[model samples]
Target: MLDLRLAPMAGVSNLPFRLVARECGAGLLTSEEVDARALVQGNAGTRAMLRHLPAERPLAMQLLGSEPEVLAEAARILEAEGADGVDLNMGCPVPKIVAKGHGAALMRDPLGAARALRAMRKAVGVPLTIKIRGGWDERTLNAVAIARLAEDEGVSAITVHPRTRSQQYTGRAPWEVIASVVDAVAIPVIGNGDVGSHADAAAMRTATGCAAVMIGRAALGRPWIFATDAPEREARAAIVRRHCDLIQGHLPERIALVQLKKHLAWYSTGLPGAALARPRLFQARNASEVKAVFWGLW
Candidate 1:
């Protein structure tokens, strides 16, 4: 079966959002990228990022770092915490991450990436995966090389975003690169980047011969994209309320309210009277206020 997995976004794929995505039919929900070093250091915030509901099972926790030992230790921790799988983040293009020789910088050193993967694979007994870009830049489009390396190191799957680090989220993702990866590696290859609708998802699968399609930014507020039928306004408002309730259940009230604001903004996009509702939604001080904005929208 073709899997529809949620991408491990930085701040957006928190527990609340993953639950919502799962409810809407996502096959797999990935937690936001957690720092291996911070997790090993016992950072409360980092540890909190790993919290998951039993209902969100078949979950994958993404870990970001350049150190083999630290990543191994972190993968063990996640395995002990009941994560179904672990993913190494080699696609992030943030400057700080690259400066630390993590994320996409690992793409520049296939040997180091393989070492990290081997260490983590040895430490955990779960399915190990990797999310990577085409490469560091246009000059070094080495996803095929990295994918083959990952396969040799016992990786269970590979996700190719098909955009170079320099391209970030801009420019069209070259599906041809993803096709090359699919041809190079025997394990499951997941094609990601610019997948906004069902058609786009189908197109990516057909074009790349990938095993699955991973949705990232497109799923920000529109979790129902996983479903076959779009919900009506009343249903949409209900989903928004359910999302807020989930957030409140998982986070402290103040923090939940703040986090809900961003989701509310995303939910409001392209709706009727969105221009007027968005400002009020952003100015909301609490969950009640956020609910009011949704109520007013319908």
Candidate 2:
């Protein structure tokens, strides 16, 4: 089956959000990128990111780093921590990561990327996957080449976000490039980029023949996008309340309230009085205030 999976977003895809996405029917869930070096060094904040609920099984822990040794060590750590699988992040385009020869920078060195994959594959018994961009830029588009290298090094699957590092998240993702990578690899090629609705998911599959579709920014406040049934107003309010409760359970009250503000705003998206209500929603300082924002909308 071509299942919909959640894309790993740095600050957004926390345990609370992942739980919501799972309840809404996501097939697979990936943790936000955890720095391999930080994990190996035992950074508490980074280690905290590894905490997952038992329900979020079939989870893939994503690690970001350029060194094969450090990545391999981090994979071992994740395996020890009960991660179901591991994903190497080679697609991040942030300047700091790129400057350090990590993320999209690896596309410039296919051999090094392959070496890292091989080491991680050998170190862990769990399935290993790689997520990558088309290339550093249009002139160096090498996703197909890298997909082949990943398969050769024993990668279990590959995800292609069909935009170059230079393109970042701007412009339309080149679905044709994803199709090219799919044709070039025998392993499952997961297509990511520009998927916002069920129709977009279907169109991406039809156009690229990808094994699955991964939803990123689109899944933001609309976790129900993965569900089979469209939730009505009352149901939507209940879901929002549950989401706020989950956030409270997972984080401190104050921090949770701060986080809830954005989610409150997101849930208001497309609502009749969203524009009029946003100012008060953003001004909310507690869960009660946040709930009142939604309740007011009703």
The estimated TM-scores of all candidates read 0.97, 0.96
lDDT of 1: 0.91
Residue-level lDDT of model 2, residues 172-253, one tens digit each, is: 9999989999999899999999999888999999999999999998988889888777788677777787888899899767
Which one wins on lDDT?
1
Alpha-carbon local distance difference test for all models: 0.91, 0.90
lDDT of 1 by residue, 154-189 (tens): 999999999999999899999999999999989999
Q: Clash totals for all models, in order? A: 0, 0
lDDT of 2: 0.90
TM-score of 2: 0.96
Q: Name the regions of candidate 2 deviating beyond 4 angstroms.
A: none
- Evaluate candidate 2 by giving its C-alpha RMSD to the native, one decimal: 1.4
